[model samples]
Target: MASSFSASWLRGDPRALEFLSDRFRHRAARAEAVAAAASRPLAPALHEVLVARNARLAPSPARERNLELLARPGTTAVVTGQQVGLFLGPLFTVYKAASAIAAARALAEETGRPCVPVFWLQTEDHDLPEIDHCFVPRNAGGPLRVALELPDAATSRAPVAHRHLGPSITGALAALRAELSGNPHADEHLALLERAYRPEATLVEAFADVLSSLFADEGLVFLDPRDPRLAPLAAPIHRRAIEEAAAICSKLAERGQALAQAGFSEQVHIRPGAPLNFFSPGGPEGARYRLDPTSTPGTWSLVGHPEGASVTTAELLSWLEREPLRFTTSALLRPILQDTWLPTAAYVGGPGEIAYFAQLAPLYAHAGLPMPLVVPRARFRVIDDRARRLLDKLGLSPDDANAPRDELLARLAARDAGEAFETPEAVEARLVSAFASELARLGERMAAIDPTFAQAISRTDKTVRRGVSRLAARYGRSITQRDQTTLERVERLRAYLAPDGAPQERIHALPYYASRLGSHAFLRLVREACEPFSGNLKDLKP
Candidate 1:
């Protein structure tokens, strides 16, 4: 949620978020953005890239209409994206899309202009390890991490888009088969995964197909920046980033100073002369090399590969013109490329993006690009009906179940023992309280009869109290043992809802829940739970 935590990204600054959050201010920005967008004009062929890509992945009438809406001069976009992740990566990927759709719908209503939700499929990123694996929830222990153990994956250093699923996928699929329930929904999801993640399917194809299977019908449009057609349109921005490397880097450093002054750190730190770009000399299967300026003016060298030749500014631009798809933006400049090509009114992102966007205000101003409104993706902890029932029976709320394993178990033990039988603490308290009162009356009588006998009464009371405490302690284990089903139920709740002591949404993948709860349940739950800009982590029982 954009609560105070998001404000910390800007700390002393609230103007931009405030402006976008307010209807009156948003209308003004929308009008201004429309005019500015008209003046700059994106290439006309942008829609063609989306249409062709979706035709292959997942296409629907709603998605086609949204693409048409986005192609128009006045229509704006609500954009969010992540790398083509394995099995949809974490649940926040789903959350990011849901929030974008909600924001797009809200922005359309508020601005009275057509708006579409666009998920930028980051097919160009070469971070294979980051998107190589995903966690699967188990009924016992916790979530199991299933990774495609392709032997070449580590050494390739190539983009996942270039890496096709290998025979190792069989083992990963086998893990899924062993772990997931044999219900009808589980069988269908398994079939879908098998179809999508075959040995020949590129990671990009598999990721796109599975995600499309889930959300394409909702009119969420996909844009792969790696599309060769988009390379030329984005080349200018890439050129500017490279051509003005020194000035841009200088401006970024100054912006870092400003952010530091405002209680934040620079999200991206390019060394003094490194441009905010990467060069992939080897093309699709090749490793991406960082673009850093050589000591000589107008000349640059690839940072990692020693054998790669240095190129002058003119040569790089010429190369970029010929093969723009070979170059891509660093995290800091990705939003610039996205907003430049699309009529983006607002961009929904998670916490990390929010922090980095704060560092980009100066960069955007330097590039003369209007910074889109940044909204935090909706956060949630999806609780199933089973977890809900367990929470109810154990007298522990979902929040309590989210506690650390040991702490939650201890509380559950105390609670279950107290209710079903009696915890040692409870028994001791009861025995002490019961005897203290009678002891006080008897002691008073003895003291009145003989003042010397008062000491004996006190000693006797102490002895009785000690004996009660000992007895309670000696039987505490037996009391906990009598918990029967309560402890097991609590463990099940922990494994599902708070695996590894983390929120389920952060730990478990969509496949885990989709198998148990149908995919439709996810679509409906996300749609219903979203409160446009509320930005809260809510609990929803599906």
Candidate 2:
């Protein structure tokens, strides 16, 4: 049996719940608007670009078929994407892809339209540290965060797509293998990871290769925006962003403010006068920089690089026309660009993505593009036999695993103590009540004797309460010490349920589960467990 819970969003954001519930009255209007916007026929050149990119990737038969489907005249896609992370990042990456695949299938069935699932690889992001590490459970005990350190050449402000795993990746792989050796499928799991994270492979290629291997049979098409072939297709969107730099900034700022006013903080901060495009000039020495509106009316200045230069709108437009691959969309504008290039029917996203879309709605409206239906991806926490047995032994649910460590430990210790130990709360409450009654009587007697005696009584009352609190603390310590086995059990459970005090899916990488439960079994569990747009955290018993 499996247990589940609703996803807890940042600052208790209700937008995801509302979106999932169809509570927003304007949802129909938004859908209609998106439908109209997507009704335009896709360009022939765009199809050629996708075909060319697909050919370069050497996609699986299923993926190649899906790419072919995407080239059809009226075909729209269901899209979801994430930054390329180590070993495919956390489990949510797989969940996100699964959700997109399921959503695409469902949408095609309902609309009688060709819809393909596309996982856009966000390889243009330059934050290397964010994707450098992944957590895996140590064979000894607890979880270990393993990272492949980058050399100076690969550590520049260049996008991750251009970065390669150097010699150091072998050590990272060795460490990962050591951790997984306890599992029966360790050899197979390590082989897959090694094949993907080869020393000579770039991060983007590695991510695409591993993801392609995992979801190839499911026909999930992987798109790398940095592909030179798609540069011309994305040029128009980049041109619009550069030309209307000020207007786009203004619209984004206005929308961000609206989102904040609606009690949701903006996910992507819109800096005043900042263009929603990252510019990377051609050449090996070129570094990525953010574009900002210049003092001149229609010019934009490159910021974040010491040698950054200003470009007139005409110059920027010319550069985009010539080399669109040099420009990348910012987080806020990526969705709009995606919709502009691909006929996106729906976008499957996580909680944060869903909240951020609220801010992008205005951007979509401003761009004359329809905001696709933002569907929250299904979230899952895999529980193997070990975790399940521990949970059952503790007689706890998955939600109980989220309790604070100390609180959970105390609860378990108390239960193990049976009727022998009284909880600190009960003891403190009883003591306070008894002390209150006695203090009241003492206060009456002291007042009768003399006013000074009242002060003494108050001091004595404070002393007694402090003594009681100290005693309670001592008792709790004693109980905790006496039940060492219970404490250990709690610790073990914590590691399994909330390692590093976070959900397993957020902390452990996919290889951890794939090793414990064979890769095929793990993938099958995820596919069977995931319920697209279900809007609930799935508890999977594998």
After superposition, which runs of candidate 1 have C-alpha atoms over 4 Å from their true positions?
1-42, 306-311, 410-492
Lowest lDDT sum, 10 consecutive residues, model 2, at 1-10
Clashing pairs in 2: none
lDDT tens per residue, model 2, 1-542: 21111233422346434323332124454345335534765677766766666565535798888877766667778899999998888888998998899878766665567778989999878888889888886533678888988755445777788888888889999999877888888888888889889989988888888888888788888778887777788887887877677777887788766655555566778889777888876542257778777677877777866666776777777778777778887888789878887888788887668767766766777898767777778788777787777788888887888887666766677787688767776787799889889889978877867988878878888999999988877766767677666667666777877887887877778888888888878888888877655657778887
Model 1 lDDT, residue 113, Cα = 74
Q: Residue-wise lDDT of candidate 1 within 182-239, one digit each (tens)? A: 6457887888788898888888888888887777667888888877778888888988
Clash number by candidate, in order: 1, 0
Against the hidden true structure, what lDDT does model 2 obtain?
0.76
Clashes of 1: 1
| Model 1 worst lDDT run, 10 consecutive residues | 16-25
* TM-score of predicted structure 1: 0.81
